[model samples]
Target chain A: MEKNKKNKLSIVSLVKKYLPATVALVPLTIIPAPAYAGLITIAVSSTGALNFGSLDAGGTGGTVVISPAGARTQTGSVVLLSGAGLESAGLLSISGSTGVLIDVAMTNPAFAITGPGAPMNVGGFNIDGGGSSVSLTLPTNPATFPLGATLTVAAGQTAGVYFGTYTVMANYQ
Target chain B: MKNTKKGSDIGKALLMGTALVSLSSYQAEAATGTGLMSAIILTPIDVTSTQVLHFGSMSVTTAVGTITVVPNGTGGTRNAGTGSVTEIAGAGLESEGALQITAATGLVMNVALTAGPFTVDDPGAGLPMTVDTFMGQAVPAAFPFTTSIVGPATNVIVPVGATLNVPAGQEAAVAGITPATFTGSYTVDVNYM
Candidate 1:
């Protein structure tokens, strides 16, 4: 049958001449680091002046302990990145860094606000001792722009507010 | 020739194994990375706190002093931690309040029986209300600090809408209470779990 139609036209011209060099080795995905979606600006002081929607509902534990302006133990800290070549990290379940300075003796309680009782240092100007783990280090190659170091006072885990001022909170997944 | 050179050596090993699986699909799949970073930056912290303890009976009383937990017993005299308790980490801890002492002649001469959380809510069912704002400061005395229990200070961890501390060892002391010099807000709502 015409020699099997000339071998199916010589295997369709050898798959169209090596198929564009095998589709140019099938690469050219040009994402270099695509998956971008950023917006980080956690900077607070004394109830942190409010952001994210301006919350203030009776505000006590959920968070809200503004005491900015020179601060004292209402300290602060934030350092987590994620947006460039991607490699940020995880585990930041926080609960307001405890600054406990007790004395009611219903039982035994006694541990007075250590770490960085936040004395103003997050975005208002570096000063973190609020340490419990918020150090992702964000400066690998030329990337450092994913922010998050709050203190609007939600009081729980122990990362409790510090120095005396706060702002920026209400984050989700 | 030899079966056409063994079918051209199996077509050049299937064309270099499809060009190395299309060049490793453009790399970066270290089996999944939740560590995505291309522009996430935030570095500004000098000190933070969480305390974190797992054991039990821990004391810290520098002066406003008085800690008397009594689970099995053996707990008192405290000046605990100190300047941020080494800056706590991971688990979390640090909280201690209620210590009113003043003596200019207003009242509350020296009342500070540690162990705290709450600060100004409920003040019961666990303990948290210890008041004494030192009417007028001129000499009062007794006011050093370093307290931090946050975690296993006997039985920490207070959550659920939160508000319950000063329960664990239970013991009150306001005795003659009359010393004033900035005595009122000794706040301590612990646990950052």
Candidate 2:
């Protein structure tokens, strides 16, 4: 019994003596770099001002509609002129480096115009050149498309220059 | 007997040293770093135009003139000749193209601009004019900019200014329409390195 106890004590002492040295070797493992690497870039610009220039709602009044697909049409008694008085759909060009599908978000999905009277709602606002909310694969480096808003008019609405601001955003998937 | 005992002691020392080294290596193999791994899957860099780049209402003289606007967001003036490049007082943020960039951090990016030779046509008249020059500057005027991922936001402001070169007599020849603005847009890309 005495001999066995002595041996056990020696083994404990040996363990204590070498424990610190064992701990010192912990920092030498090799590490490698991450497997994937790349970055993406995106840009946007209004190809031209979204101008609903000089419109005559006539004496009765009418609605001027511009579609996101670059179509312009009028309802009611509105008459659009062509002699230097041009009305055009707003064009926004989206550029992306990833060449992948991206999400587009818009602030103030609706806008309004006012002139010497109560504000008029310019509803049916669209920015994706299609539906209101859509994700699209960047077709080109700088893909140019139309963003449109429809001006709703009340009968006998006042005529003057009206203005407002809206914003469009893009993000990667 | 004495020499043999000394040899045995040396052998025991060597064995203990070897055992210590082997145990230490095993402990090291089980140990892990405490510094933590930090990473971010960067979102695509996005740029939005808050303001359009415009020289603002310019009038040209019979003489060929060049309008140069500095990139400091200052309005430009026509070179001495016949035309006038008056800074439209309080013309808003039209003199320089104001834009905002949003993305992740730790990125070294390259900025490239593709511009110039943009054409604007007179409606129905068929006489189209050309804007021969356009230029831009990145904010802080540094290439390969580095940014932080942890902050209130990870975004930068890049203000770009442009110069429009009108030939000798192209101003008055433009279509006679009020607010008959000319359009010229340049493509700017932020490439990652």
Q: Candidate 1 residues A109-142, lDDT tens each?
A: 1111223333322222211332221232222221
lDDT per residue (tens digit) for residues A20-97 in model 2? 655432333443322222323565556655556444454456777776654567787565533333456677677765
lDDT of 2: 0.53
Candidate 1 chain A lowest-lDDT run of ten: A102-111
Please compute DockQ, using alpha carbons, for every candidate against the native two-chain complex.
0.03, 0.01
The positional error of residue A124 in candidate 2, measured at the CA in angstroms, is 1.4
**Which portions of model 2 miss their true places by more than 4 Å?**
A1-37, B1-193
Write the residue-wise lDDT of candidate 2 on B11-52 in tens digits.
Answer: 355333322222211111011111010011124556688667
Best by lDDT: 2
Model 1's A-chain: what TM-score?
0.18
**Local accuracy by lDDT, each model:** 0.24, 0.53
Candidate 2, residue B49: the lDDT equals 82
Worst 10 residues of 2 chain A by lDDT: A31-40
